[model samples]
Target: MYDHTKQYRCTIIRGKSKKEMDDFLPVYAKVIDEICPCSESEFESLFNNAFIRFLPESDRIKKTMDNHRTEIAGKLFGMYYRADDGIVYESERTQKFLEDNDQPAFFKDICYKMQFPNGTQKVGTTVRQRVADGICIRPIAFVLKVLLIAKQANVFITKREIGYYILNSLDVLQGNASPYEVFEQIVKDQKDGTERTIIVPGKATSYNWQHIKEQLNYLELANLIRFTDDKRVVLNLNELQTIELFAADYDKKPEFDVYSYDLSSLDGRKVFQLDWDYYFSQISAVSDQFATSAEALLFDGTVKDEQKSEGKPKPAVNLTAFGDEGESIVYEYEKKRVSEFNTRLANKVLSLGRTKGIGYDIQSVIAEPGDMAEFVKYIEVKSTKRLTCPDMNDDLWVDTLNVTRNEWIAAQQHGKFYSIFRVYFTRDGIFMFVIANVAEKLNDGRMTAVPMTYRVDFNKSSVDSVIVPQS
Candidate 1:
């Protein structure tokens, strides 16, 4: 019994001498290597036995072994394990199973950490147990499942389709741009005294206004609006207060970017670059510290890629049919700088893009005409090159533009609309461009688009501006 106890304790020596442990160290090192592949230093230290006394495994050690086994399994499968819950959490959509159709405290914390663009509050408790287990499947599998369910629920409608549906229902509405643009114009017109209106529901405005009245009633119950005793409508203070309160709520609806448009080829899948989700997970683990200091989280920086060439020119003899081909192409690539600020902005935008209610997928990064959109002072990121810049365009570059554009556009349309900045990097390696005067100079184009021009100044460390550029 004593011998068994010692073995369980992980003690190598039993009724033996130092020579036995020395001999056993090599074999023990190999076993440890198999169990904990990631922490090589720890494994080696434990295996080397160059120091430290021998001891047997205690109950704690046994439990640790079990944990190691689970971690290994999860890592191999690219899944998350909640040891406390004894379940694996994979992609954001998979979380519904654990939510129990209602938000649970632990799951709510995780939801905020994920910053799900839709901001699902809790896991659905009714999720199939098998799915909650670590199941090997593609990320889109969850989308297909949700879409199938949404089809039945009649909520599969895209935002784009909603505009026409609503327009048809309106008595008199004029919006020629995109659906989102139309929605913006409607809201704008209502606010700026260009138009006074109430949104009513029905296939046609002439039909019975019952649905519209019902919607108003719903809004009344939510305290977002008040209807006259006769059933007409106007915004209520309580509704505005509730909007402000829930706006502060740490949750929203959930959505995903299927990237269905970019799947033109098999290799494109490898280059499709939307792995910021994983990076968001990393940032969320440390969100509390950054949230306390919002300014510290602001990113106003740059990244540069340097190229190095090797060797002098080799003899290049190549003719139509006569001789040796050109010398072998030789060059190397390196990342010049990665600032913490750049990372913070990228992570914040990424987290914002993942949010539920304000989920927006960025489409492209362009230079801002000015730091104002719709008369609101907005954050903007500028690029050194415009879409028409010939020399600056390249498919092989590892710049931020390619990685973030689509996601940003998506976020703006769906979730937290993000802003971008583009500036020409000066020869002195500083970002010194400004966009103040130009925004105010342009009037009609703010809501639509504008021509972008960036000046190069190597002297400035940061930008300061007061003028509100339109468009």
Candidate 2:
């Protein structure tokens, strides 16, 4: 009798007659049913109820059982099988497929390329490659496919609720105890650990559960860590965190805040710049001269006398002090006004340069000194005396320096992301700089003045890196 206890190499028997291979269907059926479940008892019960092994004797009897096994595995586990005389086959799950020696050479090559470069190119490319190489029938469009699978956690719920479950579960899973114990501990920890009764730890790194639940639920479903009783709930802690190998020490590490924001508020969504395109479009439609020439830039002076005298249409620009000024003085004012408008638009353009990658947060920015976190340049306009830069600790001073060398080095080693520029802006064509590099002077009440019309220049020693666009 064949020693069936030994691991099947799946090669020598590849050429066996259909009747010979059909004899092993019972063994394959038993193992598949067993390993599929989390506990042995559950698998045993499921296996016995679902299948009946036939005595291997006549080829007719063997072929009949082989077809039944294929159909059963397919329906139960999304498996498929093909037969050559009496032999049966089915596609294995990814984890099982890796260890299977009998896997087709084509599948083996696909696995090699999928895990190529040791997973560096794994992100955003796996599913596409699988399809392009004909490994899978269709392409997986996003990087989230792997994250979904790893979560072994299937089932979908609202992003907000799912987020709550993952987070609440994560809280419970920490500390020295079984995950079951972690749940009760979290409820206790939340009530007492913080000064506040409701311990709402700041924000997550990228998502807000309320806003992104559908996408998140998709992830939970593919991983198979989903709860059966509460189908909407997430149950797998190890899968949720995407940690393949769990170490007790890893659970002890410090957690960082995730970036999240509510942009619905007026203050949060305020457009700092008015639409100049609309204004120009209106001007262009008025006349050919205005459209083609600089005539559109002219300010209406005729309305000042009639409009000011008759209180009908208000003069285009208000003047607190314009007593009997000559054409030269008026020309200068008009030019200055246009320049000011352009400068304001330029400042707004600079503000858009800030995003999550650059680590600009509305909460932190609103907390910065002097309401000037976005102020890259500052100008002190004095009518009579020349504007002098204040002392290092002066109230009106702004720092336009980057993070200091020592602080930057420390941040590079220990920080999750660099704090490159917490402050930089321009006001009235004067530049103010409070960069992350000036960590020493950040808290100090120091001020400096510099030119506003400056641009970054690159030399051999001072080269600027390429900027990547966010999708």
Candidate 3:
């Protein structure tokens, strides 16, 4: 119960009766239109005006210079908007998702850190100090654990229960300790000759209950939990199935990053970049954290591919059945993604895997909302089959990838239109990491490319004529 590993806590920005997490998209869309085409340095000043302009006149006066106002902007923008090529814009189609399903966006993005642009220098203080000082906590983790805790009693949990048990007390959040074992452990509260004493949940001292109520309001707005008739919290029955998906992973830790987070802060554009990348890394874990219910991820036609051998003990993959199932999976996923824009474009998506020299494996299109119909996309698929599914924390689980000289050249040629869709074959499902504009990462000195193998050709005729022999 006293383990330091499980003692994580959250520090959500608080304001009275602020239920505005759902307003993220409309504000972002409006802010991007007002401030984009401006340099990355000009973002904050411009964002200040746009953000202030969006708030009600009465609220605007109080928040024009408020840090809470900017903090909320960081969280909202970090989740959905980003700065690319010196422009701030919305990356996720959360507005569309809500329009299609009548619900809020996913909660994972806001719960974790974000990635930066192709090139960013100094770090910023907004998100870094929060982590180093032990101020950062994933809100989703609390939502799940509190619901799980409440399941023990088949009743709603009040603010004091959460404040006493989870928010303040720490048995380290991950364990299977029975109710009796947990409450029984003590720190010798009264010892003339005593071994241990009880720590009552009722005598719970909740210092941060007011702040917790603020977060609960946001989580509730995200459709994460339900408020009972008396305004207490409980887990929705369907959320239990979603909770099952997280049986393996619930906490979004900040352990994995190829870059050095030892610095005090992060770059401005890089802040949004990191936020976007963090969100991308999460899609592989749960089918869809943004789903209205738990069953949104579908396995329509894809099946787990297994290797078969004919009484042999030499190799692992059955050579007779050696095939590009991963590529097939990627091709289908890309097609489905494009179909959201237009069926005609999705039908036009082609598998160019058979043609080796082209570098890219598939051809597709990318479309921004309220923009042009579509732009041709060049996609290179790099795939690996993991024998055991690896953890996708803040770090890149599938870190290194093999890129042919030809593929690198293709990435250089197509630039923004090019993407490397990293496809991972696991027993659970096919997971992917969409890396766009590889050339920019190379040019900006953000990503490195190392030469591993060399190719050479020889001609006998040329050797005899052009070469001189030494005795």
lDDT of each: 0.25, 0.26, 0.47
Highest lDDT among the candidates is held by which one? 3
What value does the lDDT take at residue 456 in candidate 3? 79
lDDT of candidate 2 at residue 419, scale 0 to 100: 33
Model 1: lDDT of residue 245:
31
Query: Candidate 1 or 3, higher lDDT?
Result: 3
Sliding window of 10 residues with minimal summed lDDT for model 2 = 288-297
Shift of residue 459 alpha carbon in model 3, Å = 44
Tens digits of per-residue lDDT, candidate 1, 1-471, equal 001011000000011112221222222222332233234234333323421222233422534343332222122111232322222233232232112111111122222332211111112221112123311111111222222233333332222222222322221111112333334443444457553332335545423333233222222222222323432223322122222332233122222332231334445432222232232222134222111111111111111110111222122121121100100000000011112223322222211222333322222221224442222222233332111112234221112222234433432443222333233222223232323322232333322222223466754456565588899
Question: Which candidate achieves the best TM-score against the true structure?
Answer: 3
lDDT: worst 10-residue window of model 1: 326-335
lDDT of 2: 0.26
What TM-score fits each model? 0.16, 0.16, 0.43
Which regions of candidate 3 fall more than 4 Å away from where they truly are? 3-9, 15-18, 23-25, 33-37, 44-53, 61-69, 76-86, 93-103, 108-139, 152-156, 170-207, 229-231, 251-260, 264-289, 293-471
